[model samples]
Target: MKPALESSPGNPLAHLPFYYLDNFHRVLDWIGDRYADLLDGEEQAFLAGFPALPQPSRALFVRMVMRKGQLFRASKLQYDEIGCPRAAAAPLADAGWVVADPAVTLDELFDLLQKPEICRAFALPAGLKAARKDAQLEALRAAHDGARPFSGWFDGDAAYRIVAKPLCDRLRLIFFGNYHQDWTEFVLSDLGVYRFEKVEFADAARGFRTRRDIDEYLQLHACRERFGNGEHPADVLHDVPPPGTDNEWLKSRRDKLLFQLGQQFEKLRDWAGAHAVYRECGYPGARARAIRVLEKDERYGPAWELLQHALREPESEAERQHLLRMAPRLARHLGHPRTAAGRLAPPRRLDLALPQPDGDWWVEGVVRDHLCRDDAPVFYVENALINSLFGLLCWDAVFAAIPGAFFHPFHHGPADLHSADFHRRRADRFAACLAQLDDGSYVDTIRHNLVAKYGISSPFVYWNALDEDLLELALHCIPPAHLKHAFLRILQDVKANRAGFPDLIQFWPAERRYAMIEVKGPGDRLQDNQLRWIDYCARHDMPVTVCYLQWTQQ
Candidate 1:
């Protein structure tokens, strides 16, 4: 007889069977009832015939199916660890599902768990550890059939071969509420190629028939492989039909794939392969990639030629910047060819002084004092003030809705922005939530989030000293027209732009004016993301400046 379900309604595991095999039948019955409409004709037929068999026969089938592997020690199903009566697995032996093997022993279980090297570590009887491994296994099997606590031991163990693995996996999922992650690891390991690593476009080319299919496939496989993986993309260009498939979306992906291929080749020091890949990439940065590869290989002639070609039609700011930076170095190698454009001058450094025995906080105070006084606008060298302010202001809309944003289990930040579909998936939810609120709501929400959720211990509220003044000033500085867009941009790429705001913000409540100042101390430089933010702010007519600081002898 099967183990009875508990009577209590409150227990989550109340309805579960005590025996693993009986639970398997329960899962099948449940799935058949719930998902019969969704299953195909073949699946429906299998479910229709499952229940009529005797209890032992049904239990045997379910156990083999749910257990993942076909083999098991017969005793596992028959008796509990403390010698309790469970289902007799005799029906499995009577049928072909389980084949008896007298040779099977505890040593086989050790091997199955991949612990054969530490077999002696197990607390077997005193002499067992010293005996030969084969002798120990044989002795243990004999002891099992003899009158020990391990009762009902047959001459040998029973083994199972899963004839229908996929069906069994579905049964396990329905019964246990999870597929066995370890049971089918070897069979399912290949999913890693399609999952946590980028699939070569060539490998996926045949599988993807439509343009959108290719795009989605590439997105799912965006996890880049480590450097020096000896794998190359198949020439997917010819495989993907370019004739009728003039879709711009497909073309764009093809271009991107080629560019990534070029980058991989460049990293591997395959200069010629990289150059070939880049030539066909058609991306703005492709020429730079090829040029870098050539330059690394000390092939200045080819590198200079590529640079000149790229200069004629520089596509993006990044391309232009690279050309400008590399031009002089490459020119030196090419015997300093004379051109109408004059030699590039070295960058000029600003002359400034710090107070004697400079600390970062001291410099911040000096700059703040230098910039502000009893004036219309208040100047604050607020290091983390703006970021903290934003964090507080956007707390309810962005952080509250997302679990683990503030209350993470391991105290780590949310998943990587570029990695996974994290930012892309959450961006819309974040944007829509943030857009619904007005200026007053932002202020009130910040206060609520600070006092209620974060309280006194919140890192974001550490600069609560300036919170009221900063909030009032920010109300003036943040443009009403672009508030949603600005906040959305910040949330959309939060991982990249969250922590890197400018150091100083001068606000004039009377004039309704403000300017962001990126204070660069001696040897400090603007990062790429900072430059991007500055450009973004400039385009929106938000006042921002980069201040270069230099120390002089006082």
Candidate 2:
């Protein structure tokens, strides 16, 4: 019999006792409507058979699938509704949805049993009785290289292995378009912990359009897991197939896995292996990373050749910074004339030597307190204020319901936010949003969104860091030209430029002026990204300052 949603009286969305089962059913129904073409024989069979099981049985299976692992102890699973765990599991086991007698290795066995139970099961000596659980397992592990059933280990013991976990995980992937989010998203939404923007999705929209995309996603996930499990990079790379040409999202996943594999090789000092991985990798920073590896390998000639090509058409300011730093050294090593990549002049500076505050105060907070006056106040707004302003201003373009941009309802932002074609795809929408800046309509647009879309999940907006007073102060003090300049730079490279803003911003209400400050403690040095941002602000003649602080002797 089909299970029903058991919500508390008078509250359809709250107090759902069987919310997981309801969520699972929603996924099945969604797949039946939207992704029926992508389901294979196994998935088709599982969906067809799932509803015919008893309600308690379906609930029990979902409990196992949503849980951490496949193996569940029948004695421990005591749901109030499922009176007896063993009885509920019987239907699942009989239907072959769960393994009745699965092999349990020493590692698995160690995790499942207490020390006393393990000792009693394995008949360890009396002296080993006082040892720790790990000690006892290690003592008996050598004798048992083989796996045995739970009943074989401890008489009258019962455990179950959900054989449908792989299929369930695939269903999750299909619903969410990624494995990072699980059924907990439903719970969080129901509880009002998160509120996503409503975007219209066409009936044709599916996370995976073809069956091959689904298979490739699974393969990429496996390769990532293998690499993370400390498997050899070369072995993982051998299994990682080439990225899908059609799906930028899947290609992004593949690129990240390949980039990580390359970094692993670099960590092992496998220069040749690292170069091989980076040469074919199209992930951001791959080219600069490959050049660094070539330099490490002392291949100055090839490094210089590739470095020249990169400098001609630098991917982002980050890559340009790396290539510029490399140019002088590489040119010097080649015994050629010095090459000069234009560098920006340093911005204005502010120096302070204040007694360090007590009670675990951070550097930014200390500086903020020191700088605030009655007429002017400083906020420790590290990239939040500016990014939040931009997020509010461009909400339409960011959440535009383009194909593949948003495949699911729970997305914090677009799936292809970092894809190469992200800007190209939404050029018109973003252009319309940014056009308001020139015509003096941006203030109204941003103010409207701040009130309308507040507390909604966003990739850039930090709701906690912004209040109406602070945003109003920024809008009044900061000029539209400055906002336009900052937003333009962000649009150039959203992934890289979104961060690395000044640590603190001081606003003057009466004077209608503001200055961004990058604070540095005694030993803290500026990172490359920070230097790039400071230089960008200087280049645009924006009011910015780098503050150097030294602890005073009390």
User: Which candidate has the top score in lDDT?
Assistant: 2
Clashing pairs in 2: none
For all candidates in order, the CA lDDT equals 0.51, 0.87
Residue runs of model 1 more than 4 Å from their true location after superposition:
1-260, 282-284, 296-305, 333-472, 478-511, 519-524, 528-554
lDDT of 2 by residue, 396-418 (tens): 99998888887778999988888
Root-mean-square deviation per candidate: 12.7, 3.3
For 77-191, candidate 1 gives per-residue lDDT tens digits of: 5523213212344444444334444243454444432223324334566666667766756766654543211112332334333344455554433323222232222112222
Off by over 4 Å in 2: 1-14, 119-125, 139-145
lDDT of 1 at 141: 66
> In model 1, where is the ten-residue run with the lowest total lDDT?
191-200
